[model samples]
Target: MSIMSGFCQISPAGLCVYSNEQTSSITGYSSEEMLGMGWVKAIHPEDRHRVVAKWKKCNANRDTLGTSFRLLRKDGEVVWVIGQIAPFLAEDHRVLGYIATLSDVTGRKKAEKALQLSAERFSKAFNASPSMMAIYRLADDRFVDANNSLLEAAGYSRAEFVGRTVTDLPFWVEEKTRNSITGLLQGKEAVHNLEGRFLTKTGEVRIGLVSAEVIELNSEPCMFVAINDITEQKRAEAAIEVERRRLFTVLHNLPANIALVEQDYSVRFANNYFCESFGESSGKYCYEALYGRKTPCEACRIDKIFQERVSCKWEQVHNGRPYQLYGYPIHDIDGTPLALTMSIDISELKQLKEEMLRLDRLNLIGEMAAGIGHEIRNPMTTVRGFLQFLGAKKACAGYKDFFDLMIEELDRANAIITEYLSLAKNKNIELKEQNLNFIVKSLFPIIQADAMLADKYVALVLGDIPALPLDEKEIRQLILNLARNGLEAMVPGGTLTIRTYNDADKVVLEVQDKGQGIAPDALKKLGTPFFTTKDKGTGLGLAVCYSIATRHKAKIEVKTDSGGSIFVVQFQRKSPVAPQMN
Candidate 1:
């Protein structure tokens, strides 16, 4: 007997009388030990009674019987086996003993059990999954199985779905979709995310992404398809895309520079102003692209915003003009941090603020001067007259020089008071259609005389200009004060040039002096009362000039550099409706 199968002989009592080596190996019992031993003892307890009953039945009938049962080995292991028992008979056909054979089916049994387990798992998973799934018989393309998700999504009962073909249900809204999927299955190809429209039992069309693969079901080729319903997702995505485009349009046209920056200091998006100011910066570091720097700027605030998770505002000067920058922290839907940075030019705004403050100070000083001018000067006048009257007497003749100096000092004080009063916002002014060149010429002699005394040369350049409303007296004072300041700013032999010209709808008078440029700090405070740049200067000259210019609706603009400084007063060519008065 082959060792793969166990063989044994049993007597009428069903006790093993002889056995092959295979039987000893299969039962882990030697032939001598198994002799006279009941063969039923080797059968597992759970299968013993049934197997013994069958063995006795076969012996009584004197026929062969086959059965499968578990055997308990001496090693304490259970082995499955299928065995055949043949009854040995005498000439009268009376059963005497039996011959038995057994083949081990343990490996095949384990394999079958594993297959059953896998099928059970697949069924549970297929039914429990939320994804819509269906199996179709490849031979006829008929639905063999469908999960609950598919039945609910398609509005179909299991009875209505299982036996129907794709065409019978008319499921796919497009014929091409059906043909394509069928073709893929026939060609042994898997379909992945083939988007198509399909109809429900209610005739409603729904969008779905179909993915399928060929699988074996019940020993026959079948198509297993999984569909993902994306109708709402697609619609939401479309709406989000539309909103994104609308926001892009709004930002792109904004007047200020706007940019979206990532944590890596890279520019994610830039508006028109940003792109035009810094060139194309997408996918590049912000500092390197916007400012042409190899590293981040020392004063950069963007990094601080990211690290601290806050917004910020600051002012900076770019190319000699003031700019205000604002930073706001933002996050994406996934919670990625980003920054929205905006920069706006504030040069004109800053200048306007400064001008307002300066005018406020001038008005305050002017009011003080107008309120107390005569009251203070009257006593000084009376003292001067008494001093002169006393000096002419013989008793006070020795103090005549002192008396003259006192009277001169008083006159200087009175002159300062007059200049201060001129700064009053409502100071009276006579406005007439007058030629600026004529006024400049009339004052040229006095300006030249003063320049000569200061050992400075003076030159005049007059251009053809339209006549403008002017207060000749105040115009003369404005010219003299500016010319004297110019003459004082230079050393001996330095030249001062005064010029008048026409500048589109306005008349311009410019005083040019070859002096070192004014310092930036001092330049800002130029028009405020008592704000002086000179050691012996009263500082009211320029203040009064600004006031006079305001009364005439003119603008004072200054341009200065290391080479020289120029003070320009431009008068609008329109006449005032009436002379201004206080």
Candidate 2:
């Protein structure tokens, strides 16, 4: 029926009699050569015997026969062909000649062989893949084929999976999952890494990542799926999350300010105390949040922590508060290096330590002074009486001036001994409750006169204060000494300020001077006996004041800067009444 076919007429003995134009084109032989010699001469040597046997059978039975074989062309090339022969019958029912039809089928044969090779390669790869693979018919949702991995993953045999639908097998943990997959396939949507739970034959539930695509198998639409197990990975992630939450809880309730900082000084995590002190510091530079500075602090120790891989500690003062900072290097699970810093407020602790040391020194000095004062007074009194008696003799008038000078020197020495006796351990004094404002009012006149003499101003900022149990004589001495010291530290036209107020549960008395501040070295030694900055003056003024404050159970705090200095004495609300020590 197609023009590609070739036709020829052959005798019963298999010689070519009549040939069409297509026969010459198909075999590369003209009718002149083929008709005389015979069409059997064109048969390939390899197929010649088989084709001749079929031809002889067709001739003997006069039945239609078809066969395929390779043909040798006029140019010695071999071609595959399909041929059919039928008997040409006469009126008497005897065969006249055979009618044969031939066609060139080489192109179709080559295409079929290529397809077979491709299918073999695909089968090998699918079975050898590590990931589970399956192919199911989309129409019936029945599994058509499954690889060894897929059978192993489900703990099933190949026979158990081949003809079964997903619903018939224990594959999906939920019925809704299968429905969702079907919906996606029907919509022609490819699924990628869709998570689903699966149940194996052993009743084990496993989490899997499934990917599916619609493909054609044997001219029928099918679904090809690949599954990867992710149960262990999911469990590991959950455990890490729990640990992270526990760490956060511990850091949140800690008393000190804690934070995690990166190499660029950026804060990665800040605990509750750190956030409360610095205010929402995450993603901000450490220096900017902690010190309100635009640049990093000059003494940052984060680099040292990284280099040494150990903890480092230092002290810093910020906004009139002291903090002890400790930093340690830490690496995250991903091995990224970071600094963990903890800052503790040590301002009050440090002040208390200094106060204790000062009190210990005062007590030690008082014991030594009391012992020496008594020994010097008796000898000084005898010398003063001898000098007076010598000045009174008329015969000694020429030496009277010398005797008077000697008496004056002896009196000066006796006065120093009396001052030292004030620091004795057993001196007796009475304690009485008195209003501090009344005492300040009484001292104002004397303090103002001294300030006026120096051409300085004195201000009395007295607030309402409670009555304090005090020895009025000792309290009076403490106030005057501090007030006169303030005046002396200032120049003419400078102001000396005295303030009294209640702070927390304590009563505060403050003395301020507007002048060049005390030298750093001198400030540390201010209350030490015989330590004075002024020449031609006794250094016992501040020492005696400190001793009075110690007897009253008060604390002396000093703050100095480039502008001036302030000395504050804090007394407890109720004083312990005991014998006052000199």
Candidate 3:
């Protein structure tokens, strides 16, 4: 036999008869010590009984046997050996003895054990990982294994995905993504942080960062993919972007000057209006940008905001323009404090408030004038009657002319008082349903006569309109007053237009004059008592017109251009009846 193989001959009773030099070399035993020892004694103590029973069975049957067992070496080391035993025969076909050959296989067994341990460790790590992980066969993209995280993320059970291919599962949001991944894998590319979209079992698309590499699993080429779901992170980023755009739009389009300032009074951000007005004054003091001062203003509200953590407001004037300033404290996501300031132009509002005060004063004066007129009319009537009685007496012939003149002056004074009394606050109004066009037509003759006296023309353009609740006498007075005013404002050949029309839900009575427009100053005071442009006029005409319009719940609007002026009185188509006089 070859010297490399350990050869031994045993009696049919399973005792060792002879042993080769290779036996001592393989088992670390001397030839003298192993010659008479039973072959079972060379077997490892843990495997001796099983080998002895198998050897006895083979001897009795006179059959050949092949098996592997461990041997206890003389050095106390265990060695794996593969053994083949056979029964030797004589020429007469009778069994002689058993011969066996043994080969060492310790290194191969150790290598197999190491591979099994490595596979177990890999399985534990893959399943215990937090990331979604899966192993798919590269040949057909079939899922071979998946971790618990992967199953949960995909909203699928292990049974649903273990035997399915990528195409069988609704994993990819777009088919193109699958094709791209396949091509990259085929090219032996390592996918690192590749962003892709995936679909869950519930048909939800999730954004994921995927990493994959080609690996050998169970001796077959496969892909090991790791996915990190970033769907929530991506959505949060998108919403933040939208909010940023919205904030920028609001800041850019705001009519007021808005700015963000730091605690040091340095401007951090400024809107477009602020930048345009302050000449790109970021990083400068607020007073320096707004008032051209070197230091902060005495009215700085930023200090108050930082101290109280609340909003503050004040008014200031810059370059003769009024401004209302406001300040607020804001905190960032990290709790860093910031100051927001806004300045709005209030110059027009200021002027309007002053104008309202003046109007209020005028209304008070008008009320006083009405009360005084009521007292003066009674004595004036008695004085005018006595003057008429004295002028008719024969005994006062010398002073007859003086008496007549006094009575005439008294009557003129009474007429002026009557016009003033018309502006009283508590005038009784009797509102009833009346045709506006019919009212205009009834007053047309008077309007025409007034226009003819001034060598002007009167045109009545009446339209079919709905009946409105109005006091008939007051409406006639308003038409006559407006028509006469129009006629007086026109030139000799100019036209005075009286037009009645239905506009929207109201009836409009328009009186237009083809004369030079009123002066801006006089136009503003049109309804003030005793305010008029005519030399001999008491401004009570337009004032009375406005008062009557107020009592009837109508609006009076005047439009004047360089060519002419138009006064429009719009009355509601349906209005409640006004209270009658007691």
Candidate 4:
């Protein structure tokens, strides 16, 4: 048999041959033709001696032995073979030729070679991958698998991370971190992309987003985690938090008051100023804080607020200080009412208001003086010329005395015109600090005469008022205007009630009238120019009342209905430019 069969058979001494299907498989030959071939011919020329020696070992022990040897196929291609040989025994147990079997093994060998090449490629890719990747043992959380990227990020060697559970050297984490990882493992939540801190080997901490998944490795569960450094995001978040705190400080430390309220009537939140304004009364109800009484205030402003759902303004005295309370209602995150309220100390504001009203009055007086001067000056001039002409005429003797008397009257009329001019340009007002008590007390005698004019149905009721700094002339004017308006408003007459009191900061004056009510539309215009509702009304009565109240830094409030109207003036003692001296 030729070795070209790739599995020729022969004995150790080259005796009769015996072979099997393995020889046909390797050489691609028919088994019947190969069964008689010498085994030596199956060996390649270079491997014949090695093959003979390996078979000799098998022959001596009469047992099968396996070995690798090269052979030639019938197509003359060299292929690898794994052959097993055993010595065949005679029926009487004498010596016999060697029996053997072979496998092509070439396909298997080539497959192994390809597998080795693929493994090398995968190892290279794993080392070069950008994402920090690691493999951990599922049972113990030991680092079993890792790419070079993970080593660079962790600043640790393969040995440093390998045996250590996340507990050991902690190349990328600490003990607490390890516990968190253990919890994740137990819960099997497969936590991912969680930014956390890690301590390096040199004790420097690094921030990273660690993403991981649990999987089975070599039949045991393990975690494959990928970590991405994101220290910048952490820094950004910290900066934003700092900025937020600064803004909050600006609002909370304001000089005035600021408060945060819910849509409900309850007080939900407040700032430092708010806390100071309300004192310990914060966290109570909004209405209850201002009034110590049981129910909400009768003059509560929220009723108007409910109609418009917008910012609202009101005046109230809190802790002896008058405040202009402004409330703004906004929407919270869930699109619900987030109410904010602020109280600005308006004691100075009162004085500003008074100054404005006084200026308005002077302006009106100037107009009236101009109009009156134009109307009366021409008439008086005619009277003066006629009187002069009459004196020169002897035939007009009877008219002389009449003309003379008219001229004298004209002089008096001209003098009155001059006074009206002064009233028109009325800037020079004497501001004297006077007593409200004395002023009201002085008006007691005239109350009877005013009532007599209104058929005596109107009664004047006086009460003691705080004697504070005021302009006595203006105070008197203020009372006369109120008394006069009350009588006029009630044709049938009504009671006139004037009362006064004082807190630590301000003096309060009230004038209530039980007469025809002032319409709501005409309320704001009361203190303004040309605002009145009466026949032959100059609209200057209440405007004058406004002027008097304003010179004293007072605010006028009018409440009216079918029943009557109450006009109240609140005066503050302190001012910005100069305090009023009584």
Clash totals, every prediction: 0, 1, 0, 15
Quantify all predictions' global Cα lDDT against the true fold. 0.88, 0.85, 0.84, 0.69
Candidate 1 Cα lDDT to native: 0.88
Model 3 gets an lDDT of: 0.84
Better of 2 and 4 by lDDT: 2
TM-score of each: 0.72, 0.63, 0.56, 0.56
Clashing pairs in 3: none
| Model 4 misplaced regions, further than 4 Å | 1-133, 136-142, 145-153, 165-198, 203-232, 248-365, 371-426, 452-475, 491-493, 503-508, 527-531, 547-555, 570-582
Best-matching candidate per lDDT: 1
Model 3 ranges off by over 4 Å = 1-129, 140-145, 155-175, 185-222, 230-370, 393-401, 575-582
- What lDDT tens digits, residue by residue, belong to model 4 across residues 55-109? 6776677767788888877778888887766666789755565555566678878
| lDDT of candidate model 2 versus the reference | 0.85
264-380, model 3: which lDDT tens digit per residue? 888877899998877797888788888889878887788999989999999888996889999999964336687889999897786566545544655676687667887998999
Weakest lDDT window of 10 consecutive positions for candidate 3: 354-363
| TM-score for candidate 1, residues paired by index | 0.72
Quote model 3's TM-score.
0.56
Ranking by TM-score: 1, 2, 4, 3
Residue 121 lDDT in model 3? 91
